[model samples]
Target chain A: MATTSEIQSNRDLFERVARRRRRQHAEQTVFTWLLRAAVLISILTTVGIVIILVSQSVGFFAEVSPWEFLTGTEWAPLFSPQKFGVLSLVGGTLLVAVIAGLVSLTLGLGSAIFLSEYAPERLRRVLKPILEVLAGIPTVVYGYFALTFVTPILQNIFGHDQVIVFNALSAGLVMGLMIMPMVSTLSEDAMVAVPRSLRDAAYALGATRFEVSTKVVIPAALSGIVASFILGVSRAIGETMIVKIAAGATPNLTLNPLESIQAMTAYIVQVSLGETPQGSLEYKTIFAVGLLLFVMTLAMNIVGRWVISRFRQQYE
Target chain B: MNKQESIINKRQKLHAIRVLRDRIFVVGFALAVVVGILGLAALLFDVLIDGLPFLNINFLSSYASRKAENSGILAPLAGTIWIVGMTALLTIPIGVGTAIYLEEFASKNRFNRLIELNIANLAGVPSVIYGLLGLAVFVQFLFNGSRSVTAGALTMTLLILPIVVIASQEAMKAVPSSYRDAAYAMGANRWQVVKAVVLPQALPGMMSGIILALSRAIGESAPILIISSLVWVTFIPTSPDSKFTVLPLQIFTWVSQPQHSFRGIAAAAIIVLLIVLLSMNGIAIWIRSKYQSRPDQ
Candidate 1:
């Protein structure tokens, strides 16, 4: 016992303790720097993007005041004497998006209810993959489908003279088809988050599947459903190629889906396509509109994310 | 006895109506699924019909046509590869690093919560806004009015970074806590464990996510639209500074032309683009299936 005690005391018991501390300090320092860089990068990206957009768009603001950009009825930002109307684009975008939103709201919510409340195990497995596949298809492919296939169908319905070669109806209809999966997917998540206890209680109260889904499930998942709607709107607002190709760039302020109208996204595409003298006000307007689009989508996302988070907290 | 019999009859009618309504709902759901399937099928069929008729070696090898007689998507294809490759390079390091920081090091605090929310918001921002950002910041400010492959690639990197970060974080979170505990018990430093164990295991998910992100980058039109001008660059880009054309931009230009035959070329180009997209998606699906441990299990 004496020998063991002496050996333990003599073996330089705390040797290299200072060295270990120094090593740890170095690592901590490195990690701190790395983390700071990451946080800085993200914030910098956001600030830099906003700053660059504002800087370029200043010219656009100088040439055409914010009120005019927001409220102009005619959208000929180019051509002789230039009519600078933002509403023309906004009107087209809203018409298409609203129609698409309605179509998806009906189709998507219905499917979500059925899948969550009514689907058997087998049907769910098959249907879920199909929905994923639907979301996976690229937007460009959707654009082509709109141009070649959906446009013809719209033409048939409206007859030859009524339908433009490319118009808003085809674009809106195709966009609805594209976004239905997103709505259904989000709404299903919301529906699934409803406590099973609630469902069981509803069943105890003699509620039928339709009644439970409509009243209980939907009410519980209302936040998610709202979120889905906003998300669908976000997709509609940002979509470009499909509308550009299917909905022609004639920025006439009209509610008729038969006629072609340019959207905000399409305006960016239209302006970018030609030689619009870089750094010119006309050129800068693209970024200004883009900033507006960004703000709109960002607001929509915040609302949507809030709804989703609240609904999620209510369940597992 | 008469009251009992009437009540029974009423209950039976209610059950019958409920059954009928359920059946109607089932039918409606089935109809919706069928319509969705047919819509996608119709689109694929069109791509096959128009493009498959001309999906040959000659189509892949040739340059685009000014007269619609001898146009190929060679330059665009090359540009697509270059931009996509460069974007992957840009996104992977930054994205994966960010995910690591958030998952392993970030303290659960308000600042972290803000960062998380900001990332989510960034993910949902429109792809075209990225194009505008690229135009103002990269094309003009950084490159000084240069519309090169680098501008497009840099733009796309920002565009896809949000997706990559989200996906990477999700995969990192999938790592079991027990593994970290085990490594700690074995006296491994945090960096050593993360580097030697966590990263290797999470790599497949990150790689698959990168592939999928690149697929989106390649197919993206809006940002590429503002970054790369629609010039007829017949030669492949040999450097970052060289002007280029991507598949989507090329397809857009051809589709919009006055000539009808150019439409066929656009369709062909689209088919090629679809193949790339589907292949990337396929790899992602495969990786997901491989890594999926039942959440409950």
Candidate 2:
């Protein structure tokens, strides 16, 4: 047979090309829609999650009065009267967060200072990766470490070896250690962002290196440092495994870290992890507790954003 | 003569005080550094001593029974794998897609800003809230409607979505504008620019993020708990709809048990989890270094 080139002219080629173009165009349109759908769905899922929590939590709040939810000490939702004050849970969460926050701040800030200002470059390089390892130690491992190892230490230290079997102090301390990496990393970045010119200026003014860091760099990176602290706090509040395993199941309102107390997260796990029947009042209690946590976290996020914005404005 | 002698004495005293202060500052800083390094060293040593001894084949094959138990982590290990696998499947697509939209498709505006704020806010939300969300949504609203493996995985996907989005977006932003310009100048459409030009460049970055997030999900217990994922499974979950266990939960159960053998198993589980987490971070960092060293677009 003759070659196709000989049989087909420019007119045939034009027609074929046009058809192919239409096909490609149609395919492109489909893909665009699909991509958009995926993006929309992700956003929707995030919003949908919030909506689900809010909706179910509203159902929970309608039953338990706001005052009861906020200030009530009793939390026996499965009891005859079903009293549901969440002070104990909140108190437990605060107890843990405070301990974790304090530990992370000191360790993280100190580590940050070492990396940013003091250590030689080689040492800093070595220390940074090791520090990151400390951070990335799975939270589960932290929980176990707290329960098996740290709790024993706490017991020994407090002269309570026989007492405080399931204490918040152990859980909180380990949680703090786990979050130290987050705090240090963020704070390190902020300190690194501080211009060298500022340090030189401080030195030129006869200020000590320590003075430069605390007075100049720290103040300059105030927002970043504060942001790290807030992030660490959020982490402590959200942390579950350590508290759930080490802190025990008792949700009593107390500031003492030596006692067994149930955090909001622990309660959610306790109720959901086969302790309570599905769809029962005991189960609904998790949603109620969750709502309070959600609100607190949400408020924190708003304030964090405001702080970040204020920093940006000042810097710019 | 009196004024001159007084001035000299005052200057010497001030200099001495300055030297003392510097000495104090150095010592204080030195102490902080030592304490921080020592703290991390102590924790790692403790975990290693407890865990390294029990990392045996039997430990990998057995399941929990009772206190000071003969149990190992076979069920939980398999469950962790399933959860991480499903989570990767759910999270990577959603996270990468979100990043693409924000970085390439959508322009900066109030709507986009709101989306940005929402995402940041979501990141700050407690992981347990995500658990509740997952519980209400994945466990109840969809699938088999229980605390099945699928619910736990999907819930973790939600838990990690924000971090993934942020990481992926950073990766996308690292790509040069020249790639986009060349594609557009060649008459390539927006979708083509993204699919062909942008995504290929961004693939490694996005993969790194997914790996990190998956590693995190594997160790996560709260959301799994809220989703009602099982704790004491004797058998491996062969299906997403089946009840599952995970490394974190296993470690938790073992630690909580009032038995020495169980604590040993928990330590071993932690060691395994740490290895997995570290390996993921290593890969991401290696890829990042490679990308950075290439310098030229």
Pairs with backbone N, CA or C atoms under 3 Å apart (clashes), candidate 2: none
lDDT of 1 by residue, B14-83 (tens): 9999979877877786667667777778888887887776678887888886876578889999999999
- Evaluate chain B of model 2: give its TM-score: 0.93
lDDT of 2 at A233: 89
- Please list the C-alpha lDDT of all candidates, in the order they appear: 0.83, 0.79
TM-score of every model versus the real structure: 0.93, 0.93
Q: List, residue by residue over A1-316, the lDDT tens digit for candidate 1.
A: 5697788766655556657767976886687577567656666678777887788788788878888888889877787678788888888888888877877777788778777888898988888777667677767777878888888888898798999987888888888888888999999988888899999999899887777887798988898899999999888999998888889988878989999888899989889888899877788878888888888888888888877776564555
Residue A283 in model 2: shift from native, Å? 1.2
**Model 1, which residues run further than 4 Å from truth?**
A1-28, A311-316, B1-7, B294-297
User: What is the per-residue lDDT of model 2 for residues A1-316, given as tens digits with 9 covering 90 to 100?
Assistant: 7787866876688989889878877877887676566567557766776687677777777777778788998777766887787898899889999999998888788778767987889988887787677766777777777777888888887887544978889988888878888888888888888888888999998877677878888888888888888878887887888888888888888877899998888888877766666566577677777777887877776776577567842432
B17: Cα error in model 2, Å: 3.2
Which candidate leads the pack in DockQ? Answer: 2
Between which residue pairs do clashes occur in model 1? B63-B72, B65-B71
